[model samples]
Target: MTPLLRNIVANYTSQLYVILIGLAVVPQYIKYMGIEAYGVIGFFAMLQSWMSLLDLGLSPTLGREASKLKAGVTRAGVLKLFLRFLETLFSFTALVVVALSWILGPWIASSWLKLESLSPSDVALCVVLVACIISLRLLSGIYRGGLLGMERQVVANVIAVIAATLKSLAVLPLLIWVTHSILAFFLFQLVGAIVEIVLMRIAFVKALPSVATEKFQWNLLREPLRFGVGLAFLSGVWIVISQSDKLILSHILSMQNFGEFMLATSVAWGAYSLISPLQQAVLPRLVVFFEQNQHDKFVLLYRQTTMLMAAILAGVAGTMAAYPEHVLFAWTGNLTVAARAADILRWYVSGSGFMALAGMAYVLQHARGDVRMHIRGNLLNVFILIPSTIALTLKFGAIGAAITWAVTNLFFLIFWTRIVHKKFLPEIANSWLTRDISPALLVGALLCVAAHQLNWPVSSRLLSFAGLAVLVVATTGFLLFIQAETRRIMSFFLRGIVKILCTKNV
Candidate 1:
């Protein structure tokens, strides 16, 4: 199997386990927390994401550099060198997070508008929880960084699944024990982070034999900071683009509404969490293939990944779009929050699919050491996005913000595709240039639009519409993505199911 295919297998395996287990308990947690409480969870999660903003982007860069070194060198020596350097760099990043949190933690809860309904004590609790969670995450990144640096996505995925499973299983019970109690949630997070740290250390040792020694290399920091800090800034900017909305919205809108936006954003982002591990898995393979000059293999794997992601997102998007309000209620069970979430989810899906492809392109750029171009596009995006989001949201609310996000991302994708083609894939570049994927995207969007047009009963009788919505989504998505190869895969699966059914009958 190619690197992409291998990575996909690893990612899918871990994701399957995580999804089935993690998703099983998430809804219960949400129900227990209520939309507002859940929104608080979302806010802290964003802070965690933000704290990760400074990750050296050196994860993939390290993998690329190591992959090149691996071609002719001993892994043991190289791994130690790489780890020593990373340790030094992350020490600084962690210190920065600590100082920043100490300075800003108390203020975060005060300015956020959504917390008006929440007691000052509760908001204070959330902020403290977020600060601790952020600090824990910085430490966790060390192990994750090693996995990515070694192109050990399978290992990275294993760690993620374990962490997610632990997190999901813990959330509901704790919420039940202490309803919306931020201290309780903070303690749960502290415990979970410890579990993740131990698991990650174990996983890193077993999965990537690069560094098993418990050695410190503090002096190695200066070199990595010199070479890697620029990349870290680029990564931080990208995170800001993806996550700053909540902080910004908190400033512009009330924190309660921001809480609603936070919920919608969380649900919208969950779909990606399911998909990104796959992308992370595929990337190292792409880098290896490019290094090998096996362009055809790389392109084929890229194509396969794109089709599968699009198909899955289309099905997911269509289902939510069809009975958005219904699924919203069932998923979170808070109608007011659900309504807001449904709109964001529906608008966000198209962008998710669009970005998935562009994300691949960006990953490819990173693998090729072309971060400058990616940085260029991000710079353009911020200028276009911040003003638009601020202005549109002021006029049109969350839906308007979602639309701005989607449209700006489309432009960003176009810009990246142009550069990638001009620099790399001249032959297939035209497809991206002309927006050929637009047709497939249209099919998914149209299904969502059709469902909205139908305007079915969104009341207590929503299950009836839910069934119809699921059916419509499944049917449309299948027709859109059921290429010849996918059909063959389906046939094989169906045959197995049939054989089992017949054996049972006999």
Candidate 2:
């Protein structure tokens, strides 16, 4: 299989595992540890994301550099040397971040957090453990980048599946035999990180054994660092855009509400996770495409992928929005949480779905190594989002925060599309709105309406959800892929498969 197809396959396989495991585990976590501990867990999850800022964009930049090496634009020796240098830089950075988190743990537990059940000491221990886990995860990004650069996605994802299984299932044993300790919860995650690091290191070594002899040089860092600076800034801003809502909500909402909102946020962002395989698989190739001056192919790719993403997200997000209570209840078996987060989930997923669709445009920008537009867009979000979210949340609570997110993404989508057309791909400017985004919006909205009318009781949830799934697939397929050209392509593939089957039968 092609690298892109392999990467997508591997990524989807990993995500499917994570989703299934998460569905099974979330209810157990809530059942055993209570909502208060789940809040702490959510805090750790948030910090894990925030820790990406420490990467300084090296992971992505490394992928680009690795792709260049594979394409013969850079020497393997140079790439190997640079990888060692990055390891040194990342090690030092991880130490500093971990130390800082450790020092600040007490202050966060005492001042910022509002947990009623857990002691400050226990919270502190959880914080420190989470810090360690985040540090290890951040450091692991280097190896992950190395693997992806080598197009070892299948190997990388297999390791991830094993690590995730170990982490997600860790709490069950802890809750059963050991105490239902939050510290133990994070301890398991830390163990998973250790396992992931060992496996990732093996994968990297196996992919590039020449790195063993490659000397680390300070001078080798200059070029990648220069390219990485913009990316680092963009990453910092993007993190702020994505996480600022939850950070703000943590203080404003009660612990129980915050936990519920976090759950809703998790479900919403899961939409992004579903679409990420496309983005990850496409990034390395964007560089190659640009270098070869394949503008026509690039635009075609942009349109096709955007349409595909929009169709899929629309269906998923729309269904989630339309039947959030049902979906959440099914996932958690907690009617209280389902009721509390229903509207928030609806708004958050709907917005996140669109943002994920626009992420394709961001991928194109990142691949072209022109991050100024993304930086500008994210800056706009920071300036507009924080105040708007705070005001709306004060007036309307968690749902307001959800609305603020959705609105911000709407504006960003418009801004991103304008820039993409004006500065990047003007050829499709006229048709983009009508041909691309509009159809996606229509499909999503129509499906959401269709789902809303179904009103199936929770008792029949399996059949109801099954019906929803059928609606999603049928709607998305007809709108996105049932065109004349797509039909022809499908027919050709079907004929090829049939011929192979007939030959085997003979």
Candidate 3:
């Protein structure tokens, strides 16, 4: 297989593995750790998202520079120097993160989280450990970006799988056999983060060409920093827009209720995971195509990948949104938990579906190195989303926040994508929506709705899960079959198989 295709497959494999493992283990985590403790784990996840704001866009900028290096638009030595500067900058920032976490941990445990069973002191310690783990993982992003930009995705994925296995699966044994202390969970994750960063650093250095006398230059920051600053602003706004509901709800709800909300959110996030692998695999190639002025190739890749993403994301999201109670019940085997989280999950997954589609436009802008429009769009979104989220969440609780989430992303997908296409890719804009995206979306949604109406007899959790799996497969197949490109490819393969059979008969 070609490198790009191989990279995409490898990325999908790694992501699927990680996601499946997490899915399999989460119910166990809630069972063993208790719902309140799981809330702390969810809090840890939110903290990591918040901490990414500290990156200030350097990681993605570095990834772009690495892509330039591979295209020979940048020299190896220059890329090495830039990498060192970012390393130093991130290191100092990590220190600040730790210090702030130390100060804020106690306050969050005491004031922010409405804890019932867990000790404040123990939760506070877990918060500190969360900071340490997040910091180390943040440092790993630098190397991870470099690897991806260089298109060494196989190596990057290998490291990711290893780290995920250790951090996720290994923790189960520790929790089961060693101790159920939440602090122990975070401690194990801290060790995994350390191992991950060390592996990433070594792999990144090895991937670089042998260059003598590489030295960091402070002046080199000027060009990339301009791009980084725009991205940083965009990233900050995005985090606030996306995480505001969670942050608000964290204080508003008790820890148990928050955990239930988080459960729904986590499942909803699987929609993004469906699209993320393709986005990552295509981004470096998109950058290379743009740099080389391959506009035709760039547009083709963008549309094709967008359609594929639509097929996968729509099927999963539509199924979950259409049958939220069925999905939650099948996965968690707790009808009460399923009932509690289902309404929230429905809207969240629907929102995530639109958000994932809108992300394609964002990737288009990112490849072209112009995020000014994206920044403005996000700024507007934040302004509207924050107040609305607060009002809705307070008035309606988790469901209110979820409705706002779905509506905001739907608005962004409808309007922002047009604005982006008008500027960067006007030629394909109409076709992109009418042909590339709309077909799969329509088919997937209709299939899901039909399946839900059928009301298949899913008497047990096992049968319910089987029913959902069949629905997903049928939806995906129909969506792909309706797409012209995928249909053409399928016809070619079928013709080849028929020819082989005729030759054997002759």
Candidate 4:
């Protein structure tokens, strides 16, 4: 198959399988663990979010560098160099994380949280699992990054499918037997991690074209790593910003509250994960276009992508905010927790939609090799994201904390746009601001106001959801009709679909 076809299949299949498992396991987690237990689970997940730093940005850098030499370079040589750098950097970072988790897990539980319900041992068990999972994650990065750089989504997706399926399906039955303690839960996950790595290795071997090691360019390691380290710092800070809210809550609020807050945030981020398949499929291709200095083409595609992302996020976020009870109850069967978090969902999903814009902007910066600017933008987020989170958590509880998280992105988006102009394709980036972004934010705000007001007078879940559907459809239709740019993008995307179909038929 062609590379484009291959990437699409891989992204779709992998994301689909993962989503499948997520659907099965998440409800079980909610039912069995309760909101407080899920909160602990969320905290562990965030702690491992630090592993993004381990790759720095080398995975993409590896893919870009490797792609430039595709027909020209030796695969084995490229693979070897990629491994050497990734292992060294990952090992160092992973050690620090494990050490801190070992050292600090108890202190955090006893001193920071000071909850009688949670003992030092409880936090320690979570930390240990986190460290193991972090190591497995780094290894997966090496394999997946190499595959992605090689644009071997077909193989990567299979591995993702297997791992996600196992995690989502296999664990449920086992959890039934071992659901007594946190250690058993972590053990089940740790074993799943091992199974995932083994599957990923087999997939990589099968997908790769067998190239010998004769063309080893050990020297490429030096400069490529320099780029990778920059990615590490920038991506690391971003990791902290996106995932730290839960961890911060674990620190400030009780673990129980943190879990509920984290659940709401995870539900909001669903659109991001759903849309990510498209982003992953296209990203490596963007590098090739960037290498060709096709700035106009890149900007054109970005504009179209922005509109599609906005449409999907708006529709989904609107439905979610409008019928939080309907959706969350269906998904997880926990109406009490879902009801408590209804207002927070309205803002978090909208904020996540905005965050998605910032993330795409970051990806553009990555393509341009604008590392310093990327680093600067993320560093600024730490200052804004952390303080806002603490202040809001104290005053507003979970809902306030989420709004603070969202507002920080609004702040970061302003700086990110400026740097895009100064550093990347200035001309296209300039018009990009209002053209692609404004529709979603403008319409979403109007929708949120309508959703919030509808919470009353209906006095019932079923009627409230009906009101939400009306508001969402009306808002979306209004945008499609009035916004010329939104229409243009939808038209272009649909046309591409038609062209692909015609080519297949012919």
Off by over 4 Å in 2: 209-219, 451-454, 484-506
- Lowest-lDDT window of 10 residues in candidate 2? 482-491
Q: Give each model's whole-structure lDDT.
A: 0.64, 0.78, 0.87, 0.68
What is the TM-score ranking, best to worst? 3, 2, 4, 1
What residue pairs clash in candidate 1, if any at all?
113-255, 114-255, 114-256
**For model 1, how does the per-residue alpha-carbon lDDT over 135-194 read when each residue is reduced to its tens digit?**
666666767756765566677777787677667776666677656565676677777777
Over 432-480, each residue of candidate 4 has an lDDT whose tens digit, in order, gives: 6676667766677666566567645424556555665676576666666
Superposed model 1: Cα runs more than 4 Å off: 1-6, 16-31, 65-75, 117-122, 148-155, 178-180, 210-230, 414-416, 432-436, 453-455, 459-506
> Regarding TM-score, does 1 or 3 come out ahead?
3
Candidate 4: list runs displaced more than 4 Å.
1-6, 9-13, 71-76, 88-123, 205-209, 212-218, 321-327, 452-506
lDDT of 3: 0.87
Better of 1 and 2 by lDDT: 2
Error at 489, model 3, angstroms: 5.9
Instruction: Report the lDDT tens digits of candidate 2 across residue range 1-506.
Output: 34675686688789878867876787788788888888878877887788889888988888888877776677777777777777888788778877887789899888998878888888887777877877787768888887776677889889989998999986598887877888778888889999999898888867874534456665766778888898899889888878877887787766777788888888887777888776666667767777678887777767766776777787778778878888787777777788888889989998898788767667878777787777777777789988898788788888888998888887877666667666777787666666777777877777677766866676555765686678667766776565443345346546766787999999
The Cα error of candidate 2 at residue 266, in Å, is: 0.9
Q: How do all models score by TM-score?
A: 0.84, 0.93, 0.95, 0.84
Residue 200 in model 1: lDDT: 66
Highest lDDT scorer: 3
